[model samples]
Target: MHVAEEQKPAKKSSKVKWIILLLVLLLLAGGGAGAYWWFFLRQPPAQAEQAATEADKNATKGAGKTDTAKSEGRLTTLPPFLVNLADPAGRRYLKLSMDVEVNAPAAVKEIEGQTAKVRDAIILLLSGKSYTELAAPEGKLLLKNEVADRLNQILGAPRVTRVYFTEFVIQ
Candidate 1:
């Protein structure tokens, strides 16, 4: 009986030692993962601050360049002209009128010399669209960009800055 009781205490002590060892291993693993996240997985705070500073510097530089370019007279406004489109449904045709601006002198001269061709292109583009399309802001902006792009291609330069709709009416 005495020997059996001694054996039971030894078995219980071994089980308790194993439980403690398992707890220690779990704690070590969790601490290692936390240390890795802090040191390597995450970016440093100073780097994030440096990136923000660089972005601000770039924004300021861009603003300065734009201001200087505008002061140097890189902008020019073109005279408004009304263009007529052929209407297959009736005798009367649609008319579109808008003012355009071109930044390059060479492009301006090219556009002036090829007024008939430019007008024809504009008329064709405008005539193909319905009144509802022209009425929307996004559609009008798209049309302006398309006109600028086509005119620039004909002029052979990226000179057109904007196309303004001074007058727009469907009849």
Candidate 2:
């Protein structure tokens, strides 16, 4: 009975020692990880800039071309559209002048070639809108987006990035 009682305390001490050792190892590992992160992972601004430049060089080398989307797109002015807006009294008229931002300069010739179709589409779109619908800023923005979307459909691609309302008047 006496020996058994003594061995029980020995066994408890061994388990306690193991637990303490495991905890110490875990703490050391965490400290090492924090130090590594502080020293290596935290980059200075200059190093970050160099890394970005290196990545850009690598990307350019792989692509062998500049990005088209970042390019300064060309603008094309469409002929003015004098359309009759839909109204309950049937006397509303809208004169709208627009310029389109085309992604490629070559698209200007394409747009000029399809000028009749573009004009017809815009005329139909504008003539369908009632005076009240064209009265609000939201309505004007909607009109711009709709025009861009339709023109993109004509090109079968998103060649138009933006639409400008150079002139908008309703009478």
Candidate 3:
């Protein structure tokens, strides 16, 4: 009878130890899941918001610069010129009509004030060109740059940004 009584208590102790271990494991798993959620998943959203704010600030600065450029006046046209050819035949010529766009109001006023000088300079430049030189794309670009430079020199500033060809004919 005494042996049986001791064996019964030993079995009850083993069962209690197993139940305690299972409860401890469950608690540890739940804690680890909670830590992962707090540290990794929840932190990136704030960082993303900061990045968005910085992008908006840069966009606003760019918009301001564009607005300032718009407030300045513009020039739409310059007088046309007829350029004779430099070839040995000397029979071909080009008629060039271009428009100049200026960004500065004072520079536009300056160009308007000295129209005769500008016209003379353009005539001199065009009279020296040839038909073959004026027909190519590279030649056209070079001519535009030269015209813009001459206009800027007369205006005394880097006011002209582009020169557009309204008419170009070779004969």
Models ranked on lDDT: 2, 3, 1
Task: Write model 2 residue lDDT over 109-161, tens digit each, in one string.
Answer: 88999998899999999999998898999999999999999998888888998
CA-lDDT, candidates in order: 0.72, 0.91, 0.81
Compose the digit string of candidate 3's lDDT tens values, residues 1-171: 999999999999999999999999999999999999888777587887987876766697778844333633476677777767676788887787888888876777778789999988887877778766777999999999998899888887888888889998889
Clashing pairs in 3: none
lDDT string for model 1 (16-73, tens) is 9999999999999999999999998876899989878778667978787543443121
Clashing pairs in 1: none
Candidate closer to the true structure by lDDT (higher is better), 1 or 2: 2
Winning candidate number (lDDT)? 2
* Candidate maximizing TM-score: 2
Prediction-by-prediction clash tally:
0, 0, 0
Assess candidate 3 and give its lDDT.
0.81
| Cα misplacement distance, residue 108 of candidate 3 (Å) | 1.9
Candidate 1 ranges beyond 4 A from true positions: 1-94
